[model samples]
Structure formats: C-alpha cells, structure tokens
Target: MTESALLVCPHCNAVNRVPSARLDEGPKCGKCHQLLFDGQPVELTATSFQKHIDKSDIPVMVDFWAPWCGPCKMMAPQFAQAAAQLEPKVRLAKVNTDTEQTLGEKFGIRSIPTLVLFRQGREIARQPGAMNTAEIVRWALSKISR
Candidate 1:
C-alpha cells in the first residue's frame, strides 16, 4: 500500500490519513465522508481561518479580496484556475476583506487581491496584485518543494 499523509478536511475539520496515490482519486474525509477536494477555493471565516492555517499540513494560498475591488474580481478566475491545476498538493482559500475585516487587518492586508502563502501556520510569502494562472502557480511552486 502507498504511504498515507495527514490531511485536514476542509468540510468537517477532521484529520484524515489518505493514501498518497488517492490524492487525485476524489478521496473523502474519514469522519464526515465529504469529498476532500471540491476543486474550488475554500471561503474562510475568521473562526475557521486560524484552525485551517495551523492544522493543515499542506501549503495554503489565501486570496484576500473584497467584492468592490475590480482587481480582485479580475484575479478571481486566475486564482481558481491555479487552484484547479494544483489540487491535492496545495490548498487554495479566499478571505473577503469586507466581511472578515479582522482577518484582513491582522494580516496587514492594506491592498485588495493580496495572496498570502502559509505553511505550518506561519506566512512565508505575500503578493499584492493580480497575477495570471501561470504566475500564481509559479509563485506558489517556488515557495514549496515538489
């Protein structure tokens, strides 16, 4: 059997050990049985953000954006494309600065469309602005080892 790695479920917040080979096989959470990767960015609330960043073993890329920001709207599709291509290896998330103001302030995000990359609960890199899918993937991959 292939070795399994610990993965924190985005749905039920359960820690599950899944075979590495099954990473792309639509693996479900052991406890809640929800599909692990839904191929979409996880919308993060203030409460869930801390838990997710601290518990997840994989690298997390969070897009800090607000509905009113035109740049953020334009960048949304690129972020989604990157998320879809980098599934099972990287976790993509989004935080609405308008709603989750506390998180935005805490992160010192003065600009919309800021991408923060976190690993092991600590932020490693941050970029403020819109980036194409290739640039997003390149930036993320540069920070993490494959």
Candidate 2:
C-alpha cells in the first residue's frame, strides 16, 4: 500500500489525502480543485487555524504577526520565500495577531513575529522575532527533523 498524507487546502480549508511520494507533483484539492502547494504562505484565521494544525500530517510553521510591527513586515517576504522552499514538507501559514487576538492569547504569544512549529496537533518548537529566508527555512527544517 502506498503511504498517503492528509493535507488541508490553504484556499478552502478542505482536507485532502495525497500520496506521500507524489507530494512534489503538484497535487490539487479534491473539494476545491485548487493546487495544494502554491509556494506561498496561507493566511489563516482563528476559525481555520486549529483545523490546519490538527489535520496536517506535515509540520506547520505559523508566523504570528501583526500589521503594525516593523519586524513582522520585514519578515513577510522572507516567510513567503521559505514557504516556496518548504511546502509539501511543511505548511507555512500566517496569523495576524491583531485580528486573531484570541488565538494569540491561546498560544501565549509574547512577542510579534513568532514562529511556531506544530506537528500532529502539538507544538514542537517555537522561535520569537524575525528571520530571513535562509534562517526561516533552516530553523523550520531543523525543528521538524528533531
């Protein structure tokens, strides 16, 4: 039997079962018919956040940020670049702490631009502050491999 992984659609938040070996083959969502990995971080809300964390078989790298933060703004492009490199292996997402205050409180986010890595519905690692593309990718991969 082929190994399959569950991936939550970033666009529609629909769960999809995809063959593990074919992750880099550009899989599309069954329900929404959208490409699963678009080389971009998904914008997640409080309602959709838990589902992605709980359902994804791969590690989820969440950037908890606010619009007013300067470091957050600087890291946005770096995060997106990291998404392009890390997709299929990791689900990169962003949560606006300003809008999702409840989520921020739930996660006990003490600072802006916090990078939280979740696997199998549990947080495995977390980093506070901004990082460049190389730093983000390296940090995420290092954590996931542990």
For model 2, how does the per-residue alpha-carbon lDDT over 13-48 read when each residue is reduced to its tens digit? Answer: 999999999999999999989999999999999899
Instruction: Write down the worst ten-residue block by lDDT for model 1.
Output: 1-10
TM-score of each: 0.91, 0.98
RMSD of each: 2.2, 1.3
Indicate which candidate wins on TM-score. Answer: 2
**What tens digits encode model 1's per-residue C-alpha lDDT throughout 76-112?**
9999999998878889999999999999999999888
Enumerate clash totals for all models, in the order shown.
0, 0
| Top lDDT prediction, candidate number | 2
- Please give the lDDT score at residue 82 for candidate 2: 97
